[model samples]
Target: MKYSAIITDIEGTTSRISFVTQVLFPYAARQLPAFMQQHASEPAVAEQLAACRNLMQQPDASLDAIIAQLQQWIAEDKKATPLKALQGMVWQQGYQNGAFTGHVYQDVFDALSRWQQQGIKLYVYSSGSVQAQQLLFKYSDFGDMTPLFSGYFDTRIGAKREMSSYAAILQHLQLPPKQVLFLSDVVAELDAAAPLGIGTMQLIRDGQVAGSHTIAHNFNQVEELIA
Candidate 1:
């Protein structure tokens, strides 16, 4: 393997963005109202609600108002940390109840298994909360692919497009930046990582997105880049 560590994004890289927009987002939006209403008193649930209120600066916001703000955030696909945390809780129920299995691209499944077998450390860096990331892979269509990942990261570290986030990841990995490769569907994310001396590849799965980073149509192509 060309790198000792590889960190990849989720949406549009390993999974279709539509599954997120059409399936997961809608599922969360639809169930969030109920989840919020039902679990407002639980400490963990209450804390995120309080955080949402803090974000909204409406300290006195009623439960209905908080629910409305969360739904609005979901509609806008806002990457608010509190929103991601709440959605992860909601998705946990949905996955356990067999509402929907997480979607993983066929190529991604194959490539991830192959790369792991080759002794390359694999990690995930997604905007989705770490709990949500685990749920997706734990109940994934390919079934329990969570074992493949050595660690997971989310926006709690920093915004995905910020250079500091990649720097933080490198610090945690305790490796030279060049020893790591970052794969994502977004050019700006690749741009952020590349400057830190991380190998970068953009997964152009939808036939869109051109960038200065190396481009791959699928994980197989990504493998070719590294090999």
Candidate 2:
């Protein structure tokens, strides 16, 4: 196998940034207050609310305060784990209600399916919670592509820009870094993975900026890079 595994980013890699920024984030922001009010007593929602409070160093923060804090995080595009978890919970409702299907680029859709059939283990690493990542593929416009992925990862694994995070993922996958390819649109993320010996590719969907990693305009180009 040219590569034993392929790990990919979601936004701007396999999917468009507009889907996350314009759709998912706004949906969560719109429904958060109601979602929190209805689910606050539930253990899962409560746990994340508590985590948000702790992250803000406000142990006694009220439910309203927590809601406000989350809205702020959404606006800032912060990658706070607790915020991501809550957004996933909110998005679960949206997906179940047929609000919108997840968007995956055509090139990515074809490449991911082809790679999976070729026995390259596929994984997702995104700021989105694992639940959110699964939801995207599970309800993708292409329909239920979740089975293509071998696993999912989020900030709980570690921050994407840190070399140690990629090292941790390599350890979990139990694969040599050189045999795993990591694809992302962010240069810093590619930089982090590259030093760990992971093959790195930057998606140049929004035109190119010079970077240390190999660049691909789309997943078809990435296939060429890997081959």
Candidate 3:
């Protein structure tokens, strides 16, 4: 209630889960192999590949091995930073080719604008890479909503369900946890934030209850709570 920063999850909270599971994930999975093959020599692509190798603890990993491991991670939706970074690259191609624009609920865009005007800083915390998060808002259904956000954080900091990640974010934001509101559809994520004294809001977009937290069915309800 006293927060100056509002951090939110992307999939299922700000955007429909279907857009991620059905559209975004599938597109990334389908295009990853080809994208990697084509850009393997590029510095950015090689950097992510090296990160993936480091994650796998195979410092001398070959490109083919890294690619195969990344595919496995993609299928599992692993929140590994390297996997997410690679997915962002593949998804960039999809976005550029007009596969699909990011999907966000109408109410979300309106509420975000209102909150921005009220001086509450907005940030995103997602399993998706920072690049992917930017792409989502930049190419959002509402068009170019990236400016609404103050910053983005991804798995590079730590896993979403880890309390340490919340602590790290608070440190980075230079704000006390009590003054930061963390929103997510997952109760475990809220649980992680709550113990750190961060305010918690559970987004119940699908009408499913999984944890003990304040639940808002839509961004309108969220706006009222923050107000």
Candidate 4:
């Protein structure tokens, strides 16, 4: 069946996992405390700070205390929404200052471009905040890839491994589950979407972990599957 739209994961799919774990994560960790100290009064920044405090059950938590908890979350690779949002804020500055450009695989660029030309709506659904998602694509190596996507979803919608998350995305997309293809490198994520009848493809860019779902080594291979 021809797909009407496609939603893709970021790390390990369109981009190398190291780009996130090595480049982005470390940058955010090193920069977050200072960034928050400087911008905590700003509304968006304050909102997430308040969220962090609430989630940590420390409504009166000192800014420094909250920052410490956030750093712990970073070290633990926690997927807390406030932490992701704050990281996005930090990353926005990094991207603007040219600390780094987002890493996107070359074949991903080509195949996504081709699919755009074919009139398939594209989207991103990542554990990263929507702001982070936009920042990555906007400051991507290929330059201004934000235009290629129709929308973005983050854990704010739901966790990546939850069927309810894909169900919610389908609501926003207003497309049949079978008509939306979801691409990810993790089999659990593919399993989540597949049960919802969304087409699932795993991107095995590196190791030889196995899954029953369809697998692709690169975007070129992924394109062949959908073609």
Residue 164 of model 1 has an lDDT of 99
**What RMSD does each model have against the real structure?**
0.8, 0.9, 1.4, 1.0
Pairs in steric clash, model 1? none
Q: Compose the digit string of candidate 3's lDDT tens values, residues 1-227.
A: 36698999999899999898899888887888888889999999898888888889999998888878987887797788888888888888777887899999998999889888889899999999999999999889988999899999998888899999999999999998778898899998898889999999999997768578888998999978876
What is the C-alpha lDDT profile of model 4 across 47-127, one tens digit per residue?
A: 998999899998999999999999899989999999999999899999999999999999999989989988999999999
Model 4, position 40, has a per-residue lDDT of: 90
TM-score, one value per model = 0.98, 0.98, 0.95, 0.98
Number of clashing pairs per prediction, in order: 0, 0, 0, 0
Candidate 2 weakest ten by summed lDDT: 204-213
Model 1's TM-score against the true structure: 0.98
Q: How displaced is residue 190 in candidate 1, in Å?
A: 0.7
lDDT of 1 by residue, 1-227 (tens): 76999999999999999989999999999899989889999999999988999999999999999999999999999999999999999999999999999999999999999999999999999999999999999999999999999999999999999999999999999999989999999999998999899999999988766899888999999988789
Clashing residue pairs, candidate 2? none
Query: Residue 28 error for model 2, in Å?
Result: 0.6
Candidate 2 TM-score, true structure as reference? 0.98
